[model samples]
Target: MSRRDPYIIRRLNFRKVVVVTLISLLLVILILFAFITESDIPFNLQNRIRVHREHPSLILVDLMPAFVFILLYPMHRIMNRAIGEYEDRVKESQMIVDRNTKFARELSEGEDPEPYPEMIESELGKALRMIQLNIKSGRRKEKEQTWIAEGKDIISKILREYHDPGELSYQILQALNGYIQATQGAFYVFDEVEGRLTNTATYAYNRRKYVTQEFRIGQGLVGQCAYEMDFIHRTEIPDDYVTITSGILGDRKPGSILLVPLITNEALQGVLEFAFINPRIPKLTIQYLLELGEIIARTLLNLKLNLRTRELQEESRQLTEVLRRNEQQLQENAREMQSAQQKLESANIQLENKIVEANHAQSRLHLLLEYASEVISIYDESFRLTWISPSVINILGYTVEEMMGGKDMERIGRNDVVRIRKMLEQLKESPGRIEQLEYSFIRKNGERIFLRTYCRNMLEDSSIGGFVLNTTDITESKQVEKEQRLKSRMQSLSENSLDLIMRLSASGMIHYVNPVVEDYTGIAPGSILNRSCGDVAFQKEFAELMGRILSEMNRRPVKKNLQATLPMLMGEYRAERILSVDAIPEFLDGELETILVVGHDITEAKRIEKEIKVQNRKVQDSITYAERIQSSILPEPAHIRKAFPKSFIYY
Candidate 1:
């Protein structure tokens, strides 16, 4: 564009020169004609000119106009050239503006515009390219992070909602397959006892081929992934590699195969297989899968643990049921033997058997209590302890003897005692109802602790005449509650805040956006979530500024404060707002989590500031005007003294 500028400028200069010289010549011609045709001229002017030829002064007078014309021509040319140069500069500046405008438009439209070869070295062009690079890189980062976050959410939901690894593995593979845009997928879990990887699920599987498939470590691609516990990507597919099958398209060869091992803490748990026909998977997606492997593996391990725990709980419940029946039988037999001691001698043998069963039940009950991590104590109506679990030593740092009859065993708060007493009275009246209480306590070792106590009224029962209290240490849970409350408060502050608050990852991925952003950006927080900042429809300058800020933050991790004007759509009107934004880095456990952005709308404040400045200037001008008027109208000291000799000047 600038290459032809010199030619255009030279042509303009030449045209100016021609116009000025032609006008000057025309004026000279007109003067000559006026003089030639003049009737008012003296008849002896020519004769006088000839007669004064000998006079040097007349000759000088005759040549004065020629000398003046010669002197002024160069000045006229110089002025014309200067004006032409100014016009040329205005043209070039306009061109630059037009070029910049075009580049901005292209960038906004998501088109990568190239600068002219000659303009590449210019600062404006370089900055434009840099901004383009920043935005594009931010977009890629956003996409990669979104994929990883979404995959994790899906896998986490599966882990929470399902306990069966069979169903869970399928769900995980299905989500990964869809997310990766793969043609086919499969999942396998490693069985430690069997020393093999067993297929748990397959994408679009046929019912006939639903039978489980197993492979020893180092046998196949899936086995290799499990054996090495690393990713396996192959662009070349073997003819015999026919794991992907379909009823409509049977035995279709894949273009590529990607196997990822699910590992947690350096331990292999499973392998994931994905097949792509065109081998167009993004490297970012592969990297995401690698990072997500740990979470998946951990979830699988948790699921297996949960299954084992449920089995153990079932067995425990069965044992408890047996213990209850045996205790009831033992009580019945003892009553029978007491009533018919003389008549029934066979009752002794039955009583012995029942006692033996009762002892076994008692021993099992004690074992259960030991593993239950709870303390069971009996308290009489007067709150006197009768019996306490032997587990109190471990749970409360106090032995059963110390807690059963010890003074100053607990120090309930003054305010909590009333509520607790009220609950106890209700239990006494109900005779069978259970009441739960939570309170802070001072242990025997003088350590402050928290307890959750559940008490049931059993005074009406012949076997048990006191209240049964089941107590558990809940100090750790209380700490969790405190942290949860703090988190809730922070979320509440963000939700109710007037300022726009958003969280962005270090790479410019939007993690969260407050609803207030919608008011200024005309974009809903929902639409902006999990998206790139560059992809948002922000005002031109603001979009570029956001990209620049992200780039700077990545380069140098520091808090950034920037001001921007954003366009907003109000009800039936459009408006622009000036916002002051604070971009602060948020870290968790020494790792960068997100960038916290708080944007405060300062448009109204800025407007009022401008108005105040204008008002102050006006007031200052009024004061200056008054001072000027006073100075002009003031009387001299001498005049005042003359008017009143007795009066003296205040100064």
Candidate 2:
């Protein structure tokens, strides 16, 4: 019945059996001895034996067996107890090994392992411990890889969308804080010129209070991290280290803080600091932070380098333009000198040659102004035009002769004339300094043109002792801006409308959708654009109706209005929505180009209508039932006749 039964025979008690056997043997021997001592012996053998028994050696031999048995039995009992305890320990050790093996198997299969309570001090325990360590290490490594991958995706998205350093820093800090479960964090970028770190962005920071925004290289934990180009993780945070606040719980000190330096190419770019309420942060989290720091640092450096490159390129372009203008001016000066030298050689023809050279110079300047869309004119101190470039004919619809001798003011609006007078006075007071003014001027064709004019006093030159004005037309740009403003107003109105508005091309492809569509269909407008209307309609009948409408649109006249009631899918549940849609066709150049559809959600209205109909039907049924009850209560005409067989008695 029991496992030990196989080894045991008849369930014998060894101690009892040994005692009984020894007693029996001793009794038999004693009986034999008595016989030898008391009975008659053959041939005098018993008499000889009795004589030797009186000696000391024979007496000692008789007592030895009893002493040996007494000592050996007690020793056997003690040894048996020790062996039982050792056997129990061995069984316990074997169980521990089996449990550990099961746990290891579960872990390998990516399942949670059962808890093992037995502690084994054998080789199996040490091996199991090593396996557990390896499993933990592997899990940590997987978590780190996943975290780093997600962090990289976030960082890349930030870099792609934001170019401003402040915006990038803020997004990066917010993302990092969320990933690391930090209650508070800040990003500090190194300012090379100031030799200090400046706080560029912060997460969960109070803006109304004064926060430390600047740090020296070795000032605090943040600064030290940057200086050392390493990270610091502290769990034994002091009470005064950092405070975290919750709206429900109020303020408390953070349990841990981490400071990491964003370093790339052996150079410190910035420092990132985070405070957490958890006292024990996983080492994988720290690894993620370090990897993120390197990526952020490299990305920031690239952004800065790109910005610097753009600035340099812009400066170079400006310098090149300046050089080009200077060279053109030098060429003009050279031509003028050549003309003067020729005039000096022929003084008799000097005045004629001078007039020709002056005309040539003016023509060349006019050609340049025309190519640049500029109008140049010289004005006297009395606001009289002395000279004007012929390009004014193209810019302001005014010929050079019409613009000369202050006649250009006739085309200038009255308000502009007044503004020009004030600008002239200012120009006289600040000679050789340029002033810019933008105003509207009447063109020769009675059209108002917007022009930006640069005015500078040329008082130092004796030949032209007044001001030079260069004007550029800007009417087209002004018109475009006005149109843009009107478009923006229309867009705002469409976006806020309650009814769903959409535009579809002649081919029935969705072209545009307003924001209200998302509210009705629970799908973003952007997700459905360029798709056929039939594809998105929920019901088969609605899809068929849409196909029919698109097919008839080509044959229908412009401005034809069509209406339909169709069911649409609503929300994640795909609930039926009854929509009353109105499609209005828009025509361009006598051809239908697009259809604008406006849909009103009428699902609730339809439900109410159905309920009203059901109530009416119930009311009719009640009336019929009441009539049947009245018929049963009252007698029929034939029954009344039978019952009133004695109708004559009534008469």
Query: Which candidate achieves the best TM-score against the true structure?
Result: 1
Cα lDDT tens digits for candidate 1, 152-252? 78877877887778887777767776777776777888887556788888775322125467876655567656754657777756565655221111477
lDDT of 2 by residue, 423-475 (tens): 98999988656788888888888888889988888765564677888788989
Per-model TM-score versus the true fold? 0.40, 0.34
- What overall lDDT goes with each candidate model? 0.73, 0.71
Model 1: residue 474 alpha-carbon error in angstroms: 67
Reference-based TM-score, model 2: 0.34
Question: Where in model 2 is the C-alpha error above 4 Å?
Answer: 1-122, 194-196, 205-258, 276-287, 331-651
